[model samples]
Target: MLEKKLHSLSLNQIQIEDMFWKEYMELVRNHVIPYQWEALNDRIKEAEPSYCIQNFRVAAKLEEGSFQGMVFQDSDVYKWLEAVAYSLMWHPDEKLEQTADETIDLIAAAQQPDGYLDTYYIINGLEKRFTNLMDHHELYCLGHMVEAAVAYYKATGKRKFLDVAIAYADCAAEHLGTEEGKIPGYPGHEVAEMALVALYEVTGEERHLNLAKYFIDQRGQEPLFFNEECKKNDNKCFWDDTYMQKQYYQAGKPVREQEKAEGHAVRAVYLYSGMAEVASATEDAELFKVCEKIWDNIVKKQMYVTGAIGATEHGEAFSFDYDLPNDTVYAETCAAIGLIFFARRMFEITKDSKYTDIMERALFNGVISGMSLDGKNFFYVNPLEVNPEACEKDYFKRHVKPVRQKWFGCACCPPNVARLLSSIGGYAFECSEDAIYMNLFVGGQIEAALNGKKNRFHVETQYPWEGTVKIKVENQEDSSFTYAVRIPGWCQNYELTINGVKPEYYVEKGYAILNHVWKNGDEILLKMDMPVTLVEANPRVREDIGKVAVMRGPVVYCLEEIDNQDQLQEIYLEENPVFTETFEKDLLKGVVTLKTQGKRLSEKNWGEETLYRPYRGRTYEKQELTFIPYYAWTNRGIGEMTVWVRI
Candidate 1:
């Protein structure tokens, strides 16, 4: 039953454990956790007079809040919940669980009785609820709250917060759902459907599920949100209906007809993920097919080299296929987190290892990159390239920028990562009955019931940071079972062994099966070399054709301007850069840094270009530059930075 349930993520015992606790969860625990907390602290501590104030950055000092405001509502509770649930994943720790409980309790207290919730504007006043769903993100906030409660309940078996989630959900259902007396609309955001699905999973409550379905179905149908906005503003609202029409949001068509990704990057992906869930639950093959089709379009054509999605800076949305611009890549962290959610759901729907493969990709580079190395600062938008100078010179620079921030005025990434990592365990494995399937590898022990008896499995490994792994069974002296392991698309030549005896079938890049009768003291080990890989963006991704992003194991690396003083255009790599693995004594641990020899002009004389002058490509002299994991940028002082430095 377990094998069939997780038929797709059938990873070896060692790989599953290593990826889970070592690479994936540790990145969440050590790095992502701290940054999210810092953002939350910024939100709690920096509110002006009565407003819950937050800026796009610490020193940018500009307070611009919108849907990002709603994201923080979830951040307040989600990350703590993730940490709490994670404590049990590798090994149980009492302190982690307590922290999780405390955070959830605070979230419940933060909500008011009428179900009008949102910490940002609510800190200023509750009158703002439902008034500005177009931008204030009230429903979006409620959506996140529902998600947190369901997660907390699942992770800790406590429903105190779940009740709060339900109350907020009830408010949404009662107040805004039906148009009998009020306006007819859906969240300008897309979290409610996803959260409602989670609530349904936890309580088996149909109202919650029906409401979730309602949100998905209501979208793109009648009285468009923009139309409502226009009616509210008497035509002064910022929306351009023409833009909305071209966008993925069909406000005119039912969800079953909406095909392309559109609107806000984060919202679009989240909505798609929720739709995937709805389709999976209802067994709506048509909807599920659309979900898979969108998934293919994203991974094959829309995804970033860092596993990030959503290309266009306008609306921070996904544009045409291969329209990837490194420096201008919006690559919103919430969108990447959404990509993980969407990918995971698709994996669940199809039980495909490829989904897990992409899941691991998003988790390591695209996902973790949102948080700074010290864990305090964050990048709401994880661009593949950064031009510190252009960031200052160009005011239109929403997508291209440098350095991490204390908080975002539109700060959704911080809390999204928090909740995602805190609940990272759910993405690691699945359980049904008899057969046990290992999805990821991490050193830990898990207790489960098999054949009506209690049993334990002790797994140990060095994962993302390294590839070696080991696994051992505990408690049960003898038994018969099957452990299906995933073969990564990246792994070229791999080997698996049991008790030093190699398995007859080779561990190919896409598959490896280990089916056998098991006993106590049995062991398995997997060893693979994560060769230095230079990945060029697809040919159609014109911006990245000549450039390459360095990736080893699970982390993707980039060269920032601070690490190289010369302007990016002046530098050019003569050959593939040399791989020099190094460890930052304190910050990012057990890492590889790729170094390169490049050329730069000594003269600082070349300036402007004639309107139609023929440009010349010239360069000289060799210099040293290092590429650290994209997740580790801006930790040092911010300067001119570019992930896609020339060459």
Candidate 2:
């Protein structure tokens, strides 16, 4: 592992002023969070009943109602609170903060005297608390609560919620472990590990960190904890060969021994993130090696062009190597967000650009695709190719929804998108005492300590839309430090200059670094070559043969039925096609649309009645094709969309 120690800035210390990211942050704060709160309270009449808030009220004895929503429904509220906390870091809202604080109070009221906090098991029965650890989400809810508590504590410096979370963590630590009389059960959903680590970070409790490490180390051991838990759950094992096997939870083997990516995509990534955290915090290089192996396995073999993973719709799990299928893919939005979480932790561990490259790829594409333009609607499953009819009729494609939904009973993605977007500033840059690393080319202002001095700077750019980015140093001391900008993996040729003069620099691991002293008005202008290129899949990926996807900068473009009209199957890109970039301020929230030349099969040459024809020369007509960012396609009334086109 590279020993270049790097650290991520706190969301409280950074503000997003970039046009591209600012719009999204505002949307989450102004639209998604409020709408999600309404949905959680079951106030949105047309949306599916979340009953999330109702369950908490019932558990708190303030309302008389049975537990309604999923076992993990409490997480929805926790995630929203987390988002609200992040939003409060920059834009303070009294009512929103009041609502979140009140919600936390309700959650606190529902807690058992022993610090048990899961409402489902509390409202259902105390006896069922640890009975169904394999499928139930008791620890999962606690994990989200811990994360929210940490965010709230960091954002507001309040210890009320943090104490509640720590109490819950202490309760879990007391009940579960490798010690005798304690159940050796890890979370089936795989987040408590990371959440406990976050708690340890804030509270400096060795128990929390030790508990997180214990869970990771105990997972997938022979005579598995989950298998034993399932056996105790009335001899019911999800690994009965019919349902989701143990591998579906990544508990089939020891984490260090398992090299392949498996199980639910979200759970796998979350667990991997926790492993990375424990590896870094404990300085366990062997555990980190496992993380590296799995990272390579996912990125090199199983990842998609849009940076989405998990190919199979079944269990939303990762398939074999290079088994990525576009039309039947299951790239859940939460999974992409989880990938970002995992990738960010990896970067903290190594400061490698490869990890941040994947992080940006997922952020600009798959992760953002989860939310609609209005931010009120969300897509749980993001498929690269969409066929509206097949989504309606095909049983195998039933999970693939053609349009974004306002809400769902299992509403994970909406709040996930909200939290990620609200706290996006933290992912933009990482700084050390002597240097600052710009992981994402987002236009934002940051005030951070570098080289034992306070520094301030503003990043201005319409990135992923325009390749030219300008970094203006607003305030800095007369001291030396390194300022590294990530050169996206897609950009080949680039130019970097300081104060309109060419600067000498060296590229290291995909970052263009400029180190100097005494900078107050120093301006760095980075011009990256953003030529439209057709990206081809590896030959082993059977589904993408003879197909190419459009990419410019970090954004991947796609063809939509609304743009192409019809016969999407007949459109083909020529050997060498010229593409023109145009920014439509009114289109898809002011995005850069691509226009290219292509050929479509002539309608007069073949009738639509025949399914097949004998081998014969086909005639084609030249046509103009318009491509939009893959993430922006479904917002315009999803009809059909595809990332790969015939070459």
For lDDT, the strongest prediction is: 2
lDDT of 2 by residue, 468-559 (tens): 98898877356678999998888899889999888778888888888877478888999998999899999999999999999998899999
Worst 10 residues of 1 by lDDT: 50-59
The stretch of ten residues in a row with the least summed lDDT in candidate 2 is 235-244
The residue-level lDDT of candidate 1 at 106 comes to 58
Residue 288 deviation, candidate 2, in Å?
0.4
Model 2: residues >4 Å from true position, as ranges? 1-4, 242-244, 605-609
Candidate 2's displacement at residue 425, Å, is: 1.1
TM-score, each model?
A: 0.83, 0.98
| Candidate 1 lDDT, 193-297, residue by residue in tens | 887887887789898888888887777666566567557755443446346552444355677776666566788888888888788777678877777777787
lDDT of each: 0.65, 0.88
